[model samples]
Target chain A: MTYCVGIEVDEGLVFAADTRTNASLDDVRVYRKLHVFEYPGQAVFAVMSAGNLATTQLALARIQRDVDDAAPRNLRTFRHLFEVAEYIGQVLVSSQVDTAGRPEFEGISTQATLILGGQVAGERPGMYMVYPLGNAIASSPETPYLQVGESKYGKPILDRIIRADTRLEDAARTALVSLDSTIRSNLSVGMPIDLALIRRDDLRITERMRLDADTPLYSDIHANWSRKLTEAVHTLPRFPWELPQD
Target chain B: MTYCVGIEVDEGLVFAADTRTNASLDDVRVYRKLHVFEYPGQAVFAVMSAGNLATTQLALARIQRDVDDAAPRNLRTFRHLFEVAEYIGQVLVSSQVDTAGRPEFEGISTQATLILGGQVAGERPGMYMVYPLGNAIASSPETPYLQVGESKYGKPILDRIIRADTRLEDAARTALVSLDSTIRSNLSVGMPIDLALIRRDDLRITERMRLDADTPLYSDIHANWSRKLTEAVHTLPRFPWELPQD
Candidate 1:
């Protein structure tokens, strides 16, 4: 299981993903779920995935192969962000189709879902959730973010904090908080978190970091959010029965 | 869809449920989902449900009818809280089987899941989640709460705030926060919450409320929580890059 989110605010875009991958309860390992494809000042795309790891790795390799082979249609040649999402979707579906045809593998789900966020030289910064069926939906002003896998536990905070005009850094912080909430509630989504930021119009990933369980920054954010949330609950108005009679 | 939660703390239990019911996005209505069976000083039980409303209504009516007709095994005759839960699970399962056997209802689901929290005079106060399969599980010290229907969005707060030692009113407040989060995130769950409290050994509901959108206490709790959550986020430590460089 994995939890990855992409936010497209007016000022920039933020992407975060968990690193834990488990084939079974006893077979847990750390694997990078965030795939970065960058051309520095020209364009940058961050792909975060959840589902069958083999399918995602195959899809990622296909993407890199296409770029290395300089295929007619590859990430580098795409003029828009959605085009990149479409190409990745096709790759992801094709990768799953490989194992899906075998009768022995019938019970396993070789599906993968992805969040693609980036900006091209001329296109605006945006986010898209590419479904396992090779379809995609872009984030709009009203819904400025997209999430995949183990998403619900972390969604309330995003619904409360994220807006189109939210500060780029603040959106990054919110994404971290969202991930933290999910990690604490679910064992499948664990640390070292992959975080990336893209300042609108920069056409590049301005900064990136990996936050582990002991990362001071991530630890502080986690602890502070917990304390503050408890404090917030404590400050809510008391029930009528709890109040002293006038 | 609905959102109902039953929490058990050292002091007592808290039950809260949303009133919204939707057949479709357009065919939405408000219906009570919390049912209380109190024998005052003898025993008390709160049954909250989510799923096919017909199934729940049928199961609820059966309980009352059994009491009215003096059935051999009725809620009033139960010796322990688990016995009551087991009885409810059977009733709920039987209600679903009614439509399950009909060919015309094959495409629709008549299943219901329930949270039963109460106490028999001689038994310890406890809570149980009765499954559609006619099985039930009791809340333990590690997990002092049970939630049914649209539960994920509201779970983070419960995990953060509730414990075996948490104050009863604080647990009630946490339940409200959980419901508020679910209501905001899901259109299927909505307003006019039904809240009830059962103090340990009290053998009756100490306080009950139906909080509509305009209810002052509910409104205040909602508004203040939002404000305090925003403030809490603002005070979190800034990103290293967000700080001033020396």
Candidate 2:
């Protein structure tokens, strides 16, 4: 199980993914779910995956292999972000099908999902959520955020706070807080997290950071959010049913 | 779809449920999901249902009918809260299985879950989550809360703040906050809430309230939790993602 969230805001896009993976409670392990394919100042694409680890890894590797092979058809050579998204979708489905034929995937849910977001030269930054069936949907202004895997526990905060015009830094802050809420509630979403930022029209990666359980900023925010939420609840007027006691 | 939460704290117990019912998006309607069975000062039970509304309603009706039959076997005749829970579990499953045999339910999931918690004449206050399989589990000191249906969106704050020793009033407040989160994140879980309280060893309902969408207290807490959460995010230190300047 995992949790990954991507936000497309006015300042840019924020991506965060938790690293923990588990076959079951007793077979927990850590694996980086975030993959960055970048050409520094030219273009950068980040993909966060959830589902069968082998299928996702193979999909990522296949995409990379296509790019490295100087193949006539590949995401790196795509004319636009949408085309890149299409290429990713096509490659993911093929890889998943190929991997499912192997013994490792028996009885496992082989379906996978990926959040593909980044900037490419000469295009507005774009974000797409690619489904396991090789279809994708781009985030629009009305829904400026996309979440994959263990999404529900962290979604209320995102729905209430995230907007397209939010500053990149603020979006990143919000994404981390969202991650904090999910991690606290679900053992399957355990961290070390991978976070990335992209500036609109920059066509390059701006900032990428890793946060673990001991990270000072994350620790502070987690503790403070809990305390503040409790305080907020305390400040609400007592429900009339219990007013006599109060 | 639904969201209901139950809490057992040192002071007593709190149970709350949203009223929304829908077979699908277009078929949405609101119906009371909380049922109270009371014998004045002798005993009181609050049951909140989630999943197939028909099954839940039938189960509640069956229990009530049995109690009214003046038979030796009924909720009113139960000697303990666990017995009441067992009775509910059996009735809910029988209703679900009965409904599943009908043509209308052929393609639907036969899932139903209930939260039964309150006091009986001779026992301490108790809370149990009754499963569709005629099995149940009681809340304990280590885990004093149980939630059913569309529960994840509202779970984080509860995970962080709720404890067995929390005051009943505080627990009620926390339950509302949790429900508010779910309502925001899930369209299926909407307004018109039913909330009931039982004081420790009181063997009776201490307070019960219904909260509609227009209720000032409900609206205020919904707005305030959102505002407080946004403010809380703002105060968190920005991610040190060193992006290029605008």
Candidate 3:
């Protein structure tokens, strides 16, 4: 299980993902789920994956190889964000197909879902969720976010806080908060979170870093959010039958 | 789909359930998921059901019939709250068996899960979640709440706020907030929630009420919670890279 989220606001795009992966409880491993492909001031793409680790790694390796070969259909050659998303979806499907062909892989799923967020030189910054079925859906102004994997626990905060006009930094913070909510409620999602922010029209990654459980900034956000939530709960209106406080 | 939660705290027990039931989107209906069995001044039990509607109705109908007949294994004859939970689980299993025996129901499931919370005369107040397999688990001091059906969206708050020493009214309000979160995040769980409160050693329900989306009290809680949450988000510490505000 994993929790990854991407938010597209007026200022730019924000992406965050947890780094824990496990075949089973005892087989837990920490793997980087956020991958960034940057062409300096020309174009930059951040891809965060969830689901089958082998399939994701295969697709990512192929993507890196394509970029290395300067392939015609590679991420660098894409003119629009959606085209890049479509190529990622195709790569995901092909990777799954290749893995599933082995007789030993019977009854195993090789599906991987990904969030692709970036800007091409000539296009506006955009975000999309690439599905395992070789299809993708773009985020909209009304719903300025895309999430893949263990999404529900973290969604309420996103639904309440995010907007198209939200600042990039605020969106990043909100994404972290959303990821924190998911990590707290679910054991499968753990820390050493990767976060990336892209300012609109910058055509380059603005801020990209990994936050572990003990990272001061992440720890401060977690502690403060928890405290504020508890304080907020205490401020809820009293039930009608309760005696007024003295 | 349904959402029901039961919380056991020092003051007593809090129970809540959403009323929406549907076979599909077009087949939606409102049905009470919370039921009470009370022998005034002697004992009271609140049972919240989720899953197969027919199985739940049959189990509940049989429980009523058993009480009517004063059967040896009926809820009325139970000495401990766990015994009543066991009786309910057996009734549920029997109901599923009876329904599944028909040829027309061959491939269908008639399973129902329930939360039973109340106090029997000599024991402390208790809450048990009866599984479809006819086994039940009670709430413990460390985890004072149990939830069933479409439960994830509402769980984070419960994890952060609920404790063994929480006040009964606060617990009830927390349950309502939890239900509200689920309703917002899921279309399957919806309006007109049923709530019941039991005070320890009272041997009777202290409060039982239905809260629809429009109920002023429920509406106020919803509005206030949303506002407080947004305000809380604003209070979260800013990321170090963020520019200082004027």
User: Which window of ten consecutive residues has the lowest lDDT sum in model 2 chain B?
Assistant: B237-246
User: Which candidate has the top score in DockQ?
Assistant: 2
Model 1, residue pairs in steric clash: none
Clash tally for model 2: 0
> How well is each residue in B53-77 modelled by candidate 3, as lDDT tens digits?
9999999999999999988888778
lDDT of 2 by residue, A1-246 (tens): 899999999888889999999999899999999898887667789999999898899999988888899888876687688988899998888877544556776676777999999888877888999999999999999999999988988887787778777778878888888898888778899889899898887667788889987898888877777777777778888777546863
Give the local distance difference test score of model 1: 0.89
Every model's TM-score: 0.91, 0.88, 0.93
Query: In candidate 2, how many Å is residue A189 off?
Result: 2.9
Question: Where does candidate 1 stray beyond 4 Å?
Answer: A93-105, B70-72, B98-107, B221-224
**What C-alpha RMSD does candidate 2 show over the true interface residues after superposing them?**
1.6
lDDT of 2: 0.85
Residue-level lDDT tens digits of model 1 in B1-246? 899999999999999999999999999999999999999888999999999999999999999999999999998998988889989998988898556567888878888999999999998899999999989999999999999999899998888778788889888888988998999999999998999999999999989999887888788866667567666777777777888999
lDDT per residue for candidate 3 within A133-172, as digits (tens), equals 9899999998899998899998887887788877788788
In angstroms, the error of model 1 at B80 is 3.1
Candidate 3 residue A143 C-alpha distance from true site, Å = 1.9
Give the candidates in order of DockQ, highest first: 2, 1, 3
